[model samples]
Target chain A: MPRLDWEIYEMIERNPFFKHIGFELVNSSEEEILLKLSIKTDLLNTNKTLHGGVHASMLDTVQSIALRSLYQCPVTAMNLDVHYFAPANTGHLFARAKLLQKGYKMAVLEAEIIDENTTLIAKGTGTYKIVRNA
Target chain B: MKLPVTRSTFFEYLGFNSTKTDTFHLDLPLQAILLQDDGTVHPGVFSTMLDISMGATASLETNSFATTIHLNVSFFDLSPKENYHAKTNIVNIEGKVITAEGIVYGQDGAVAAKAIGMFKASPIKQ
Candidate 1:
């Protein structure tokens, strides 16, 4: 188990969906991390614009991914609060998240969604709870 | 156009009695299955859609500028059929926070979910 626990980093690296969405590890400082993603056509919503689900999914995934790298056991989102400043059109989307505070088993994440132009399209925060599975 | 073409008909169709909604307006008989896991409509789909509806209703009530800041949702049950429907209204608005509460009825006209949200108005620099 000691060997496998140390191998989670490599296991996460092999996830196909994370690779397909082009989620990249850019930079990190303290508890904050930056993730870069490409704007793909299939990520759009029913209005031909960016789907809200995509935004939620991407934000949720990156938060969990970043947490996995730092925590002994990964956490899940309990609630999400998002604010959209403008429409996220076709272009590169960048999500940067930071750990605002971490409790014994809960943490708060503050993140922003920026486009290629560095425009802030959405701002979000979530509460995560860590639990034991095995 | 993140919404469907029938988005306009909601005003005349849903029999509006409150004149305001905190959620987005969506019509019934959606092209989604109520129960499925294989990329078919997941249970969260209804919640997401309902959240969107509530957020949209906030935009309409607050002079079309209110943005979603706090959304509280509670799920009570699931739809037995594939049909989807929702109706909402603005409950109140504080100085910076606007509150909207409404109910989402299942295809059988039973309550499936109830939600209350607070949308923060943009800060004005004066």
Candidate 2:
């Protein structure tokens, strides 16, 4: 796709684990990016349903990556807040991550995970502490 | 037909009101939600789920009561924007701290996210 960026695409494409996770860079700009995942049973929980921990880990990852896209520094997730509405039970999910705001020592980012039906699965905000090696 | 109450049946001993029809149960196959323009899920949701699993796993080995002091999650990539599954199993059970690991799988059965967290348990306070 013309909208896809080579840098991130190459990074994800190269990672063995990333490839197994079934996520690839769909598109990217300077401080924003999109990720996609295919839904399946292995991701489900003992309840014979999808688990919430899955979403939490993901939002944290994208938010950090969204920041790394511009600034090359070690940013760690200091705090995370997530909210779930309904359930993300089927199909692929589409996520859009953008730089909500940035500070001198930390940054705030937001993410949304939507199912194939465009239903909202979960939403979250995170604060990443910027470290040295900048 | 009989009382199903027991020391281990917390969910049931507590008298959870889940109808038999409510068979839907699930966990996060990823770390957190994606916050792209299209939409995304939140990490807090996963944290909550992790807490639930951790609490349950801990209760199994614990004596009476327990509380979670702190939980730390090291997230690598965004949980897939697509769909996936999740599995959580207790990793270790210690004296005061209960440690557990939950792994989320993406479309390809790969680890979408790996989380190691801790929960504190104790006997019922007298």
TM-score of chain B of each: 0.63, 0.55
- Across A1-134, the per-residue lDDT of candidate 2 in tens digits comes to 12334554554444443443356566576535777777666555333334445566567657766775656554666666555554554688877776778787888888887887888876777778776573
Clashing pairs in 1: A47-B1, A47-B2, B22-B54, B23-B53, B23-B54, B23-B57, B24-B53, B24-B54
Per-residue lDDT, model 2, residue A73, is 50
The DockQ value obtained for model 1 is 0.10
TM-score: model 1, chain A: 0.79
What's the true lDDT of residue B19 in model 1? 27
Interface RMSD of each: 8.7, 10.7
Worst-scoring 10-residue span by lDDT in model 1 chain B:
B8-17
Best-fitting candidate, measured by DockQ? 1
Mark the regions of model 1 whose C-alpha exceeds 4 Å error after superposition: A1-32, A45-48, B1-47, B55-126
TM-score, predicted candidate 2 vs. hidden true structure:
0.52
